[model samples]
Target chain A: MSTPLLEAQGVRFSYDGRTPVLPGTDFALREGDFVGLIGPNGAGKSTLLHVLSGWLRPSAGKVRLAGRPLRDYTARDLALHIAVVLQREEHTFAFNVLDLVLMGRFAHGAGTLGFESEADRGIALEALAQVGLEGFENRRASELSGGEYQRLAIARALAQQSPILLLDEPTASLDLAHQRHLYSLLDRLNREEGRTILVVSHDINAAAAWCRELALLQCGEVVRRGGPRELLRPEVLEEAYGVPVAVGELEGGQPLVAVRR
Target chain B: MSSPTPDRSQARRTALWWALLAVAWLLVLGLAPLAGAAEISLPRALGFGVPEGEFNPDAQILFHSRLPRVLFALVAGGLLALSGAVYQAILRNDLADPYVLGVSGGAGFGALLVLTLAPAAVVAFLLPAAAFAIAAAAVLLIYGMSRWRGPHTPPATFLLAGITLNLLFGAGILLTQYLSDPYQTFRMIRWLMGGVDVGSYRVVAFVAGVGGAASLVIVWRARHLDLLSLGEQTAHHLGVPVASTRRLALFGASLVAAVVVAYAGPIGFVGLIVPHLLRLVVGPDNRVLLVACLLGGGVFLALCDTLARTVLAPTELPVGVVTAFTGAPFFLWLLFRKV
Candidate 1:
């Protein structure tokens, strides 16, 4: 009923001329929706997310955010409204976590290339607190464990104060406990903070358990889009993945998935 | 798991260490002019009434010659160090320096060309401006070549282009050297040696003015420099205009390096060594690292110049030679330690 917070109207892209990565893809998101994008390798899930976040431009069609075309917003303007957490952390310099988090406010104000004001520092500390990193702000980022680094990145995104969050494989390298913690954090942001989140993941069970709606992509096309109950069925997943998978339920009534022998 | 809070007392202690280092640097720079070939009284040096004695040529020599040279070394050293720190942060490579990117070679070639072609042109102001223009052109050419395909010039590709340009310009310098007569050859050699005979007060003021202004601009952009330390993609996602910011940084650093190289004739190693050493002491926050580099470089070069004059007695070794001898070994140590 309400205008979608983000919309992709027939987006298409190709790295090389002949082979298309995303073929005429159309998608939209409403406010506070937790959407999971799951697909096999080469399904262009990451490309779709990149386009939505304005990191990539589509060969054809348009991507609009908050009813404005992506091109209408400067990179800084877009960044103020959307935050992307990439998969790998490859920083060459050693910066303390608090300084790194404070960088999220770079697009906000004016103080010598937009210095960190008191309000900016307050927001950074609050974001760190949200990600359970309140006291680790003085630690060097290079010294962080993989899970701690991921949390720090989420904290940075939170400091951006963006309404839209895009995460690429947030749990891929995380341990089990960290993975659960990350999922709960995402859920909290989406439900309580009213942030729209779109996650690209390979973990089907995590997707089925946490996402209200899931889109199954195969060969650069959405094969199925529905509630998790419908999309997690054995037949639909087997079609998308091209492998036999058993879909079952746990005692808490969440969907569980496993590869069939 | 609970995270450990940073101890306030420890942070205060770290600040105190920085303050002590700053004071030590100032002391070294202040006292260096006194240690030259001549012996001047502390009272005379401090402008106290001169001792009731014959006109001390020693004090005159110290005031007129060594003090200005020492001042040149201090300012140029700080400029080179700050430029190096900015370059390393912007390029996201520790080995990156304004000189290494062919700027020094281009500037040298430009100055030589001007000196050879227009022998009558005033050497004071025109020479340095010509050198800066040529060096900036070389940077723009490299940047253009790297970006012919797209807006983004990846760090690896830019570094490769810079290395190639450096070699090409270095060869050009050799050609210029070979084609010249004995008079030209002697002048070029002296220039290459990076001595501090800056001729007059006007030159010193010019260098200090430019270096001082550019350093302030860089310090103001310290926050952006921090964002840039994260790889370009991450910086972009965090709202940095990676391409434009990088270009601006290179341009600013080039201006600073060109000014110093023009005045001092391409002093070696102060840029590379000062930033590297400072980074080891104070982590990689550019805000702190840049300031430390300015202080450390000024002190280090001032001390080295003192040694250059006093160590060889009547015959002074070129400060550049001392810097290379000191810097090359430290660079080797860094590589091995990093490995």
Candidate 2:
């Protein structure tokens, strides 16, 4: 219907000129959509995310964001439009949670290298609050637990205030409760805030329960793409994951998937 | 979560750090010239008023010797520290310094080359220019080597490349020393030890001019340095032009290191120690950290030079020796403390 917020057509990527990871891949995201990218290990899910966010260039074809070629946007302009929550970074520097979060405001600020204005500070604080890390602003990032750090990372992207958010394996280190919290937060941002979100997760049940659509990546290709109901069927998942996964349902008819013995 | 609130406390704390460091720096500036061999009143040395009973020779000593030496220490220390901080940030390692990137080694080689080739009368001009050129070249070589794996020079590769370059330059200097005559060898040895024994104001002016320009460039890019600490990809996502920023930072920092090494003969530890110490006091914000390093580094090196001149009372150990003696202990303690 409307122009897709982002689209990749026949995109191919390789590492060190080896075999292509995303060989002949095609994907699209609509505005305000919650999409989950679920794949088995080494299926190039993270690589695809990097390609979409312009962190990595595809060897063939191109990615278009907001009807513009991804390469057409400078890093600054692209950052202003797309916020990325990377996997848990190492505690290399002694930046506090607030400092890390405020970094998200880098692209949105006015001058060449703008200082954090009062308004920027307010937005950063609000973002921290949104992630329930308000009082933890003064805490060192090194001091944060894995789940708290993930939340802080999310807070940083929230502070970016971009229209689109891309997260890679956000729930990998998170506990059950934090995972639920993160999923709900992503859902709320997608629905209430009208932010388009593409989250990569290995948790199929969680992906089915939360995301409006799921894209199953098998090896390097988007093998199946549809709503949870259509993609969570046993035959499709079995083909993609190469595991006999039992696809069942919750009390509310949400899909539940478990690996068959 | 509580209502959104500005971090007034952090802001106030940073302000307090600035005020305190500024005041302490001014005090060091006043007292630095007084700690040398001859006694000179702080007021008289600062040119506030001539003391009624002050001797002309002591005043002459203050003006001719101590004053220039102190000024040189302040400027050179500030430059070295700023260079160290920049290297540490761009290279993302605590051990990254001018010496690590072979700047000091290349500079040392340049100085020895001047001694071996240029006449004594024209050495003052030739030495610094040659050193600066060679040091910059060495850094460029290091950067080139680090970029072997595509565009992104990973921190580990960068550090290893620097170490390799340092060894290569170090061998060159050693060869130069071996080839020189006894008198030239003596001069090279003294220069390599790194000292702050300024005999004239001209050297002071040269260092201060270059150091001031370099510090300004660094402060202007301090915000980028802050973003860079997040690592390249994250910083890129945050809109920093990582490649250009890396290039500019390397050029600016290497220029400061080369010029200071040219003038001061590769004074040790001020660059490495000042930033490490100040980061603990002022958090990791580069805006504050860089400025604080400028002042704190100046004071630290000035104080160390004072001790170098006075501790042995006319024996005059090289300022580098004093710095290593002091810095080595702190560095070891820091390592053991695991901070």
Candidate 2, residues B202-309, lDDT tens digits: the string is 988977787788778878888788888778888878788788888888888888888888878888888998898888888778877888888888888888998988
- Using lDDT as the measure, the top candidate is 2
lDDT of 1 at B261: 87
Please tell me which predicted candidate would have the highest DockQ against the true structure: 2
**CAPRI docking class of candidate 1:** acceptable
Question: Which whole-number lDDT from 0 to 100 does residue B206 have in model 1?
Answer: 88
Interface RMSD of 2: 3.1
- What is the C-alpha lDDT profile of model 1 across A1-261, one tens digit per residue? 999899898999887758999899988888988999999999999999988888788989889988999979876888888898988767787777987887788777522342356677788889898877877987888889988898888888888988999999988878888788788989988889999999999998888788888998887888788878777988887887789989888987788889998
TM-score per candidate, chains pooled: 0.90, 0.93
Q: Name every residue pair that clashes in candidate 2.
A: none
Error (Å) of candidate 2 at residue A138 is 1.5
CAPRI-style class, candidate 2: acceptable
Native contacts conserved, per model = 0.53, 0.45
| Ten contiguous residues with the weakest lDDT in model 1 chain B | B1-10
